[model samples]
Target: MTDGDARLTDICSGAAGGKMATIAEYYAGKNVLITGATGFMGKVLVEKLLRSCPEVKALYLLVRPKAGQSMQQRVSDMMTCKLFDRVREDNPDFHQKIIPISSELVQPGLAISPEDVEKLSGCINIVFHCAATIRFDEPLKHALQLNVIATQQLLSLAKQMHHLEAFIHISTAYANCNRKYIDEVIYPPPVEPKKLIDSLEWMDDGIVRDITPRLIGDRPNTYTYTKALAEFVVQQEQDKLNIGIIRPSIVGASWQEPFPGWIDNFNGPSGVFIAAGKGILRTMRANNDAVADLIPVDVVINLTLAAGWYTAVHRPKSALVYNCTTGGINPFHWGEIEHHVMSSFKRNPLEQAFRRPNANITSNYLINQYWILVSHKFPALIYDLFLRLSGQKPQMMRIFNRLHKAISLLEYFSSQDWEWNSENLSMLMSQLTPEDRKVGRPTKHAARLGQIFNILQLTYEPDC
Candidate 1:
């Protein structure tokens, strides 16, 4: 076998045993405080921990009341989601261990009362910070407020936890989008996070919006810029806390735990896949060779949990960074993604699809615009014409236009490749037992397979 293959084999063997042992020791009586427990990744993290590490003492979730739902009600409803079905089946009373803390991260001191802070400081052993705004077009001030400032506040809180073993921060792999190669180590922030926060504090929304493009420079959106800043903020707490950062790229549906193809929101590539499958998206700008570094939620959570163990047990001198990605290790390109997505839709067509989910990813702007005019715009025009003739409203064109706008915003990510150095991820895998590796490997494989199957089955139906 090649050196890398031989190493993978050894690592897989070790993971099978070590993973369970680590879980047994680390979670036996430990309490974990998690933010963003309502988000996609955060939900999976909570589910996996409760299911696999049953002996974990307690889980304190930092939740904010949304709409009319109380924090406790939200947590209760969250437990009822299909994502936790497996966990529910495995441990029927898992919800009893979850403790919801009502606090808004964007507020000063995360809006936590001194009493709540004191209680957490004494009781919590680990903290998983997973909250952030993922909107590509989010306004600069709000993005920075939630992504960067909230992270700083959380770090300050983590430093107060007397029994804290590890503080794991979830970040996106696209944090450093300007670079082709992304390393596990944190890159110096473009501008100091604190300085940026202070400067933005005095500026109004319009002013911040006007300067965002110039400030971000080559990075595509505010999401990535603020994420990079958050990483730098987390690194600042390295001295007092056992900090670990997990950067996951394009999180998609669940792999194995709850069920395969269990996706809730229309964010990131999921939106693109769903829109295209429904025949709303017809043309997008993307390169065929660009690596679609889509990692499943479960895989990312698994790696995050593994990192938590390593950070707590080893307590490395520097903060541990895990580039939890599958692109380099199991490369898949956007072209293949397009092909599979199209095929999946064909087999299992969504209800009320606009037209057959036939689309192309192109690099040339003129060609893309041409296809948009001919294939997308023309079809909508003709369809609208027919609808008008039949005495119906012409809405198809408007819907296509909105989908076009959404796809345009996502094209940058689809047209590029990111090289993430995952040495720490490999190292963590090496520490797992052979059985644990066998279990975890299937989760990764199932996630990839599910994505491919969904893409092919949901995007390529004859009547889509």
Candidate 2:
């Protein structure tokens, strides 16, 4: 057999669970490189690595200065954040193992200096690429630059790493949203990514905007389109590198780790939940019966770390795609989420509520639109009028408008369900030792784990 065939066979075989190293042992003394160490999921990943894999040699975080804070300051601030409190208590000197490397994903060579690149290429044993613009309204040009171009650049840097054992790329499960049944394999991209890049290079913003609808076809937005393209881009390097792609669906707050319902940002359903809890979002376009594939942030990180270990140890000939999802196993619906969120918020009560938390999800287009006017816009109008009469800025209406736009972008996902075959995910779990599998279990250590597996252990068993 050819070398490529041999590698493919090895990946298909996976690792023997009985003889595999423990999660902590696999990570010991490894120099790990990570991008997006400052993101919501990235922060959790870093914290878990430090607290769980205490003996890891070092963590090289790629960061760029943002919001007036230097990269060092941002890293320092991140280490001190409440999320890392458990890790801090466990090892106050955890920060010593974290080394910040300056780099920008949007620029060529990821904007890394020659010396920094040389340093990374020498000692880095594994790479976790987690950075990408998750905004729905992001311009096509900017999205492609960060998601596709930057990924290609990172893969190039990975090639130069003499000691690189695995390169794990974080992708969205929605990347293949056009298909109802998504198998654990890279689907053909809508357009040749390079061709699309070449075509868009010369087009003016107006022209590009005009044609985006046609280019994306059945997909919802530039975010999913670019993510799909990015996956394809990552696949180009699988022949030479041991790579793993993690595609998580609807990442939610920690279920049991640092704390239950510990979420910092208002992205995705977080915003919807927070707004609904605040009694502001009363209605949203979502299918009541469709599966809500909510996977906890901690679960994704655990699976990612496990994938990293597997990819490094087994050296799979083909990159294994793990469809990290919850609906397939433990199905939850938007209707249930709406019910639970409303119940929880009403019980606990947000500081101030616009109205009682009574949010509803509906699939009917006209019904959703009607509720948007009655439950959302009308209240905002009244609130804005009240503010205007009080000689204050009429901000409620503006907030609703932005909220409307965000909801519109997200409705496509919530309104329908997709079937993702996560057999690869199960295989990875089987490779883990019982102790390794229990690392993120809530029983022994709530600080190190959240009740992630308790949810994922139940499988959806898709035929695909």
Candidate 3:
């Protein structure tokens, strides 16, 4: 560990040398506020907290009505998901502990009702702000509304909370991807967030879209750019609030917790795994040796809970950022992932493959484009023609178009390497009690990955 991280451990432990409470003990009887409870990581955070900290007083979920479902209905449906089966078995009335607060993150004041606001201000002990627009192509103005503005509003609300102990913000490890090396500190913003927000408010949509490129500068897209700004916004509140920021890299499948091989966070490698298993994706540009940095969702949640406890209990003077990545330690490469995935598919292949399971990756741009034309477009064109002749709507080309867009967005991260210093995570884990870290040694990533891949055979989606 670096001197900075070693010092952090000391601050977390202190010189009293007293017996510290375990993670569950600290969270007992605490009222927790969680935004984005319906999201991939947010749901896992909720499940883990309920399961690990069984005595937690209540969970207040900030949710919105979507697809005609009310906030209460959404929370009710979420509680019944297969993801919560283990929690259900452990505590059949787990639903009683959840209280949904109507909130639309993009709206002013988060659109939270006055009653809900008053309720939250009086009893909330800890908060986890996990909501953000993760779309790579999301418009800059809309992205700012949800990621930056909503965060500011939430921070303001936290100031009113009489019992609030800690606030943990979720950010991506690629927030500072412009740099080759990233440390456990928020970098200077690309542009001042307040200034940019002020400018965008007066401009029209087209003007904002055109100026976004100049504003974001070297960052790949609005997602990373805005996430970087959100960190700064969170940092600004350090004096008034105990804050901890967790930056996770390419969140992958669940590790051992409720169960191994559960696949909920499918936005990462699972897309490639499923598409390739169904024999759709054949080739893409990726550096074979680049560290993939696929941190499991379960481990990320564990680290998140640990950080929440540390920030609330130790009360660090400065806001601590935890780069919750696996690149620096237990390094895994893209080539190893492709090998394991392909091997698993061959053994227990998906029932319906568009072609024989033979997919490869390339580092060369020209070679990848060549394969895209020959392997991707050519197959889609032929398949669409067959469908047209059979009186079926030709849809292969549309699917391929979406696949190409996804690949274009993914290749930037896949074709390069970024080093994230995760000493803060190590320091946080070092202070946890044995029960908090009681899972079996999980060094056999190869086997764990094989289990995940084999399970994917049963989960191949026909839709792109």
Candidate 4:
């Protein structure tokens, strides 16, 4: 067999042993820095590192004060969220290890003070960059500021870190959405990063909005465009820094660790699944057969830590890129997702559901709109009428309308799939010990199916 075939076979076999031990061993006693710790994936990465690698030195989290809260207060509240229940149980004082630094990525030099920089440069061993603007409708200038410029600044800091072992940048699999098949290697960005940043600096928001369609060309939005540019910027550090990139497709709920079906935000498929499960969304435009590419958060985090280990240990001449996706290994279609989501909700029904969880995806726009009126609007209207007759406020229809709007914004991802080469992911897995593989196998595919079944059972349960 060829080396590639041998690597594939090893990964398939390692699936039985799990991969957590190697990851745990690698992160032990390492001082790590993470950005975007308050976001979905970032939170998971922080929790997993603390829970699985408890001996790690410390975790420096860059956080900006929001609303009226101080940086310390925000980080404290974030740790108390339900998402950290597992970690709390395992290590009751896990929050003590998280050092919150007041730094805003959009600010000049990412707003990191000289003292904080000195501290990081002296002690930090690894950095995970997970911060990015995921908004599909974010203004071009704002997205570029957060995604592209922030990355450039972070690379400069990484260069200054005397003890830095690896720098992992979390990028989206859809960064190169214009192409159907995406390889592990970096592609030349559509526009030069500096040129785009300079042009947007002088343009007004209205002007940027007006020309966004033309500027993006075949790509759908500014989010992907900025992400692609960020990848290019990260690649520039390959010669001097031990860098790795993890491009995960649409991130979803936890498949195994912590708990099954644990999701917090209303982005990507999570919003649609929750909206549909609540019986609020009835029709959406999507290709049933298109690969959904929905990866579990735990799987992505696992691959990320593994990549960090590989970059630090191997120090390869080329920057490693790991396509953390499921399509190539276990292809699942939107049609199946729709079926499972509806079934799950039917069993574990939401607090207040609309007409049973009966949403459908379609390719034809007209058909979808027709169902939106008949299946969605009509039921909501009838439900509102009943509530009005009972002297109650009519609110169900309004909520369904908002849900429909949210789903409409997310259909673009569901209607298409991007193929990613994961050769590096395979290589990283190969370097793990047999014991490590046993703990990080990700429950295989059975756990995912079981979670869907449990969701269905909960939705339809009479008491629920």
Best by lDDT: 3
The global Cα lDDT (0 to 1) of model 1 is: 0.81
lDDT digits (tens) for residues 295-392 of candidate 1: 76766777788788878988999898888888877777888888888877888788898888887788788999998888788888999999999999
Predicted candidate 3 versus true structure: per-residue lDDT over 256-324, tens digit per residue: 544555555447567777788889999988889998888766778878888899899999999999998
Instruction: Estimate every model's Cα lDDT from 0 to 1.
Output: 0.81, 0.81, 0.82, 0.80
Q: TM-scores of all models?
A: 0.92, 0.90, 0.93, 0.89
lDDT of 4 by residue, 1-464 (tens): 44322332233233344544345566788999999998888888898788767778899999999989988998898888777887898789898899999999999989999999999999999999999999988888899999999999999999999999999999999999899999998889989999998898998989999988898898888899899999999999899999999999887777655555666666777667777877778789999999888777776887787788778877888788888777887777889888888876776778776657788999898999899889888888898999999999999788877777677667778887778887877677667655444333333474356346334422211110
Error of 1 at 159 (Å): 1.0
Better of 3 and 4 by lDDT: 3
Candidate 4, residue 410: how far the Cα is off, in Å = 1.7
Worst 10 residues of 2 by lDDT: 455-464
Separate clash counts for every candidate:
30, 4, 0, 23
Model 2 TM-score relative to the real fold:
0.90
The predicted structure with the larger TM-score, 1 or 3, is: 3
Model 3 error, position 449 (Å)? 4.3
Mark the regions of model 1 whose C-alpha exceeds 4 Å error after superposition: 1-21, 385-393, 438-448, 454-464
